[model samples]
Target chain A: MSSPLYELGEPVLRATGLSKLYARRSSDTRARLGEVAGRVLFGRPPKEIQSLRKHEFWALKDISCELHQGEALGIIGLNGSGKTTFLRILAGQILPDGGEVWINGSSAAMIDLQAGFQASASGQENIFLRAAALGFTRAQTEHRLNEIIEFSELGDAIAAPMSSYSSGMKMRLAFSVMAIVEPDVLFIDEVLAVGDFRFRQKCLARIREMRERSAFVFVSHGMGDIALFCDRVIVLHKGKIHFEGPPKEAIEIYESLDEPASAVDTPAQLTKAMGPTFTNSGALKDVAHFWCDESGAPVTNIAFSDNVHLSLEFTSTVDIKRLILGVPVWNLNAHYTTGLSTQLASEELSVRTGERLKFLLEIRGGIANPGTLKSMMTILDGAEFLYRNPNPDLVIENAGHPTWGVVTIPHQWNLIERQ
Target chain B: MTEKLLNTRKERAKGVRIYRPDSRIRQNGLQAVISISREIRNFRSHITTLFTSDFRKGYRGTVLGIFWNFVLPMVPISVYIMLVSLRIMPRYEGLSPAVYISFNVTIWFLLTGLIRQPIQVVKSKNTEMMKTAIPLSAAIVSSFAQLCFDTFVRIALVVVIILAMQAATKWTALFIVPIILSASIFCLGLGLLLSILNVIYRDIERVITILLQYGIFLSGVIFPLASLGPLVSLSAANPFNVFISSAREAAFAGSISQPGALAAWTVVGVILFLYSAWFFYLMEYRIRGSSE
Candidate 1:
């Protein structure tokens, strides 16, 4: 319940039960009139007037959290999960319908990178303009003007009008200016995805340095970035906090939302018939059960460079001749990385009516990056798919190096001496 | 007990400070005014930057540059003079045609420009205004400053024409300062209201454009208000007529005829500005939401 970083400092920013509701667009004339009349008479929106219209939905509801100094809190959610709304409310750009938010010191938000730039003005002129918009005085901006220019690395191009600059140059200028200001609290929303990889890495390093002095609230959909940067994480779902905990567990919860039980047909019936470990496709050929083994013993977790054995039990109601069983492995993002098929190995077999088949497949866990790997057992009669494991739930936890992609190939590096 | 624990925790953390949310609810008119004034004061430098940049950029591409600011108002003056000289339009008997028409046209342009600039500015900069935390009043102030610069040029043009026409200078001509200030305040009050309204209702801009087209003729900018015959009372009662006639009387006749009505309008203008500003703050969130 308590995080090490959370206890390092006091909460610099806090929100209690913050909520916002937006009314549906009114189509009825009388309801629109009533809304206007209520505004004119009471100077505030009437609570009952919304009921006269179609309906209203909460964009955010009863959300509460505290951000401590020297800590970074990551907000992860699917689109339309009120992540942006929460950031805007915290940034003081929008007012919440219910509850309140408080901050301790001066804050700046890069919610939109090009929010205050004048297209007709030069980059140097826009730096001053945007700084002024952020409430910095002319003298203060002048003091840091050179540092900003050097950091942006625009060089002579800074003298040209912003309309001529590329989008990457614009983001660099915006990010440099904001980072140089060094406000006590900073809000960044998915701005790191822009520009090339090198600049993105530079920006990330800059933000990490900033975190040592200031609190940061970062909203990103990239789980890798979240894992690297966040000290704590919160998962938002349907305008509410679905989960709040460590980064790894929160990522698991976020990924699990994509795997709906309905994605696999009759999951409850299958779990009841074949125990909770099995997932049945209820197709022409049903995968009634599955399990994994390491060195002939049943296991769920395996170390790096170790071999894993997978066993799948399937049955077909109709006669399936020349059946081929295949295992397709996927990474955390559901991207297929590798597969093994009986047909490729010249191990095809012929089956009769109501025949049950058991297939054993061996997989190398050393090739996969350190994370979760999912496997789907598929039964194919040549090109036609007879059945597939409706729920691709056979997860293998890999204990490998934190590499970039799903697969890691073996290679060697040597140092050469130069004259 | 929890409060004590929080305080102790805060004290242990050397430089960290705890923040608590302040309640934001419906505020009275006085509270709204105080908050708005505070916000404007806080963003004073931002307003100045916006004004200076806008002024420079307005004339950046033109060959004539800032001279166009003076030349723009002269087009109407030249057309009116040609009409009177060619015997197409009747002239005032007591006042010189050039001085009367030039003075009235200059003041009319200032008023109309002040009113129109804010609405145009808010529409054009809608994206920046919504995305940044910059105060909305800053944009209004910037537009007003730009128009004031143009007004000064027009005023100087009127002065030069009066001297060329050999009109006698009066000691009371200095009263033009206060008269012009009052007119600007009135323009600002109406401009702020219309700018906020234009964001909510797109049709307001079109309606104001059509109204301004006919308004110039009715306000006696081209001729004397006394010559309107059956429409004389309505023309004389118009606020624009009152401001223009006072400006002319100060410039040529050397005295104002109706000081009471002028003072009343100025007071009304000040009151209108305060109320409009409060209304703007009240609808700030709604305006931002609806625009996006």
Candidate 2:
């Protein structure tokens, strides 16, 4: 999969012993004075009392990564895992306390979106300011003016102060100026966070487009995005690269949470279709069945579209008569998705003592949204509720859109838009 | 490991594209010195942006676009000079009161500007430094550059006043250049030092205003330096005094009595600069480890 596109004649970029040491600031006034005093061979001054306290932190430490020309390097980590910090260090926004970071291309960093913008300046003015901060020359900014403006879509507000802009609007202008005016190495720090879903898609596409002409150091918490966009994904933890390779494996390693499985559907109807033959002594107690995988192990993240089955083995300790059962699917958030009740056609089952019936519900594919969805089954004696149980947090993911509310009605839009 | 990295970079180089910072800076010395030139070259544009931004941030959402930038001390600078000339000049030599007032105003403008700048340089630090790779001194530099612009404007006004006075231009007028250079270095050094102090403490802002007010009157900005006698000599000890004296020597006097003023202040400025730079570099490392 990693076929080299260029001849191996030269090295474009090398991060040799690439290290970043962030010196943490401490509030030891006496210690500082002593250090200064020691350096000068003098008695330490009395610890002066200053009411200001600032501490230093290492946002990035000993990070080393190499990006070939046209290679998209994805930095995946949780918030504050130093992904953005590493990108910024590479971008040369701040100097490392120790070590050297060498890159062989023009680098631009969006460490924080619109980092240098003056809110009082108009979007047009800020475009110029931000462009220059991004290392573009006046002539270059001038050449890309139309493209930037169009992408910004700031319209009449281009002449208005950025303070008057909405957060989305500001990101719009910043993204437009930087993306339209390409750099040799573009560092994006979760820029997908700025805009709404649709605009985020557009920005992602633009980032990909820019990758053709430049390299990208993209930091994101979204595994799907990293998998889709990056050529190589690195998972960072605590200012270090924990895993480096394919995004899928990285995602599996990244999300090591034992998230629970969801259910397929709620058994809808419970009706007996047989002649009523009943031993009144018969009773079904506790219909709540714990869901497990094919290996008979308790499993989570059970897909609604999976052949994975949910089995309800109700114990019939009494001589049961005309037992009716009902099943309801409820998500982890306590929202019910779909419910099904037991149905029998023209027959009623007479259970003997200590009889246990195991009903397996099988899913064809996986659930649409395999997030935490729970399930519950209830058994009613004849038309009266003898026993019922509700098991919450049974996550069943579907092979469809994770719907907003509980019930999802199956319907199709048959009409075309009017001409 | 070296072989793998070299191989990847080798292929990358074959692609014929390189980031500006990643590549050589032409000369042999360049590859060693990170192109900090970009930081210096962007100096003017940064100030232009900051001045425009500050002018707005200082008064935005207020009904008064306030025009507060020029008006803050512009009135005191004018009114104080007039009051001083009325109170003192006629008692001294029947010299044109306008001459004393004009000179006083120009000196006050430059001195007050220098006094106000170092404290404000700190404000720029708390906001802009940690976010970008922009050096901590850059914010101070931009503010100092603005002060230079202010000094230029005041000097222009002072020149117009002298022409109106029908005074002869002196050989000492050449002294103004050295004076400005000294004042610039002095102001920048002071600004850098204060900016560092300010990041640690909040009270520097208020204290600086007090310093500026008392400094203006004591530096003989509102009154002639000669009237204060030995007190004026003490005023001359103030680096800002050299700023005024240099301007006076260039524009007003035939010759300044103090020969070594400019050289002394220049040395003081350099010392302050080096000290502040060292202090800032030390703290800069510490500040980054703290939460924003």
Candidate 3:
């Protein structure tokens, strides 16, 4: 495996001091006209224009990176984090307000897979047209025409107008044309998510092969793909390079930056909890303490096939009658596992103002897969939302069989001798 | 972890330039010119592709196909011919009304098509063009190429009208070549400037549409220049009038008029072309960013 450090060489692409500032646009025509009139009459823009200038913010600020040949760099960020802007500037589609990008080789960007396609033109014609738009000559496209058609698998549909093709077919045709061009440097932005799973896998494999020959700058929100393909990863936050390092380390930082669900108070638990707690906070009711057993001791981890008791103590500021307590479990993938509610057991509980309530719950540990299981607490009063905690203080770590998915079920395998 | 990575990479990497906001090196005018020309040269294939695709797609779905290119301008030309034949409009001296109107409208159509399409070309293709590696200049060049194709079809229609009228052909008719070239260059310059402006202030497009609508009447396309009476001087001074009338004179009368004015317009066209190109290069980034 080629680690980032092992693949070091002369940089094929370098970007420095790349900054883009966007001024706020005023939608009101009167305000725009007033500003223009003010400038014409007084030789200066009015106060509204000056204030609009203040609304400007840098979409990309001082972003600099280098990529060597045969190395793939991944950029990960949330929406509005400047990943797209950075890619565009690097691809030379958009010029930066400040800074310079030096690319030593020809670059191709698959930023939008469907760009430059004419709906009225036949699929075969669009292939040539799109190839030409990507700087390929007619002879060059003609040489690869058969290969593109075969890869797209459109067959007779190639003769039909592009408007008749499904979105996937269009994407396939676009990718096929893009795949034939062997640029020295490639910039891809979220295009790996195109087509079906098999096609996606094929595209990914092709990208891997291409990366072996050229430097690649990839932008994707999928952390798993980043870890699988990228040697180095950069995490952007609010238009700045928040972190850059190995893919494993960078993914950790990126996951941590995700905005936690509303009720999860991770910061407070980090300081308060003596052990790991998967969920925290109760929205309507404040979760004071949680214990795993009658011993009132916290349960940090549990083994498979073991029965465990979960206890939650909470206080409500408002009086709630016809109350129902619910505990919903989620796996690491955020897939819903199971939900247990007091109403299902036909149990009733009432709490008055300033009253503390304790609920004890039990779980058969073998039913849960061996991974981190987050539990959410919800307290409802006759279908009215009284208090709900998406991330509570109670967490069950089921140490069971090494399996995938939210829940585990037991079964037996048997063999019958037949003549 | 990030700090460690940065430090190790910084030590190992050579010739990796780190840029910051304050460290940008500004290019001079000469350097900018050279760089822009190089960029345009590199994307020449893209320009041609975009042009041909646009030209083909413009008439793709129509029943008449490319014939519409010849037919659309003739509608108004026919209307003006009927009006002149019925004596509703005064006819030009020593000129068939149909021939005069056809030649003038054909050139007018070419000028307006060149002036109008560029404003919407960049804006309409904003998403696709920006996503691709093609430069904005490629789209501009493509619009000009399409205009050239449209102009060719219109010119064909004008030639047919001249033949049908059995008008006398003169050697001086060759002068229309220079006039057409100069007028095209002028329109292209104005189009380039307007395209960027349209991206900045979308109202410029609407304003241009209104201007073109009124401009047809003032351009002496459907009527004779002598009929303007007191406004004849103002009409004569209009650049559109000069473009149309000069061509009509060369094609119908088989002689050149206002040679000095034609020369002046050619100079203006060159100046506009250079100034618009320089201005576009300067504000390209801002124009693109603003659209977003």
Candidate 4:
């Protein structure tokens, strides 16, 4: 995520031990009234005395980070890990209870994309309204109006009231306006989770183009996006910075901190018959799932160039015929990455009841897309699923090339001069 | 954070903003007033833009559009004049009943508008202010601008009536300026205070609505409060009563009763405005946080 344009040492944003505390108990109206009454009767006692008396816990505690120009910083964490609290403090939307944050230039937080839009106003009017909210002058907004309209691809719909717009169209207009504004520092919280695939790609490209002038602080649960955008990543755990450095190593630590993936109890709907003729005769249970390298030792992490041997162990409850194994890989966002199945295999196999079978599906090279990937093992007889083993996620550590999409295909290019 | 970096010319050029636990800006009354003035000035464009949109949105689908500003007040004025002419209500003294009722009713509308608009704006805009960087000052000012537009039109209508009646326009009538200014400042102060409290207490808006419904009768918009006996002194102490009645007397007859009381309340109004604005600024973040 680094580039030659990055001013490596010129930090535009700096935070020193920023922390925020939230009251565990709600500060009810009665308590607030009593506090006011006490102040009026006894006069001002002291600062922090009342707050200290209340039950409070720090949502963020002594966390610090710095960002230089043209660099993007990624923050990733589980729920309640303080990622959002840290981002809010840095964005200046919420003040930290302790410590200091200094930004050398203006910053804009795209926390809620449609925050200021007027439902009854037309898209054309709303663009100006949103521009004003962003502190843009009329002249500046006018200058960029045509480009924004062209980028949004709203065309005739721009004249229609925003209430009539589909949510995707609204997101397009909002993102186009913000992306065009180009603040000195940008704080984005999961805005890319919206829009279609094409629009998201356009937004990412726009952000990459804006990197020359802006530094980004991005918060997302998607590891692929984190690896794609951030030059440095901070993994927050329990209100503290548990890991910080390169995206790859930080992601590794973040994944390791989570409880290892365990077997999900098979839902009843999946075990139901797909057709009237099909009956629930047998079920499969996952015993072991892991990936290994050429040495045949269980490898918890796999690199892109390494030969991948996906080993799975399962036992069937009844005798099954013409059963084929299906291995489906999915990214953390539940996006299908790739499908590896024995459906295309020429040979079919049969298994007896209570027989424990181990199957290994080997790939010449590892998955190109990098992130923590989950795999489901499905034993299919034609179209009906006899057994589905979906537990124990497969983690892909690294990719050889920076690419977009679920899986990158092996390809090459050759230069030739035509006579 | 070093002092050099805090306010240095180079840092200013880069727009360095530093926030700490005690980073709240400490300002006295005069400084707070100055800061608020500067913020209003810097956001004047936002004020105008929001004002134009809000004003237009008020009458967007109507046939008459801006004329409703005049139409709304005329209905009340006409009804009161008819009642007075029909001998159903006591006549307004010292001026033509039509002129007096129309003029006083216009002023009363202005007062009611000043009292009512702020709470509505702050409530409707609670989401916008909390979710975005739009300053509360800009929203307040823009809503004030709409009221200003309406008041300007109503005053124009009053002037036309005065010209048609050929009443002697006295030079001393200029006293109405201070009367309106003081009243506006006082209502704005009270409105702002209530708007902040209204975010935490949902009943404040309803209470204000009920109070305004009874305010016109108590203020002697149609007839003198002298008939009410004990309510005369009671109305004198009421700022709305003092300002409206004083303004009416000044504009129609060139003299205001209880000038000393009006002056005292004017001073009070100025102090209230300053304190309320300062209080609003201090509680701004807290109010926004609680608005959700």
Give the interface RMSD values of the models in order: 5.8, 8.9, 7.1, 4.2
What TM-scores do the predictions have?
0.77, 0.71, 0.77, 0.79
Residues B88-175, model 4: lDDT tens digits:
4434665677777778788888777776777777778765775676667777788888777777777877788778866666676898
Error of 2 at A274 (Å): 38
- Would you list the rank order by TM-score, best first? 4, 3, 1, 2
Q: Candidate 2: TM of chain A? A: 0.65
**lDDT at B201 for candidate 2?**
57
List of chain A TM-scores, every candidate:
0.67, 0.65, 0.67, 0.68
Give the DockQ ranking, best first. 4, 3, 1, 2
lDDT of 4 by residue, A1-419 (tens): 43333557588899999877665554553244334333322323213322544566678889988998888899988777888778877877665667889898889988788987878778988888888878887788899999999989999999888999999999999998888767889998888865899888988888788776789999988888888888899999889999888887777777656532332223333323111122244466545667776666787677766677877777877777878877776665555567888888888888788989987878866444666666776667667776565636566655644446667677778777768
Q: Model 2 captures what fraction of native contacts?
A: 0.14
Give the CA lDDT, 0 to 100, for residue A2 in model 3: 31
**lDDT (Cα, 0-100) at A158 in candidate 4:** 93
Pick the TM-score winner: 4
CA shift of B76, model 3, Å = 3.6
Clashing pairs in 4: none
* Deviation (Å) of A70 in candidate 1: 3.7
**Can you tell me which runs of candidate 2 are displaced by over 4 Å?**
A1-61, A97-99, A193-202, A257-289, A293-365, A368-419, B1-38, B42-73, B82-98, B101-105, B111-122, B125-141, B159-169, B201-207, B224-236, B274-292
- Lowest-lDDT window of 10 residues in candidate 1 chain A? A271-280
- List the lowest-lDDT window of 10 residues for candidate 2 chain A: A269-278
Model 1 Cα lDDT, one tens digit per residue, B58-135: 777799897776676578777876677786444463567887777888888888887888787776765567678666
Which docking class does model 4 fall in? acceptable
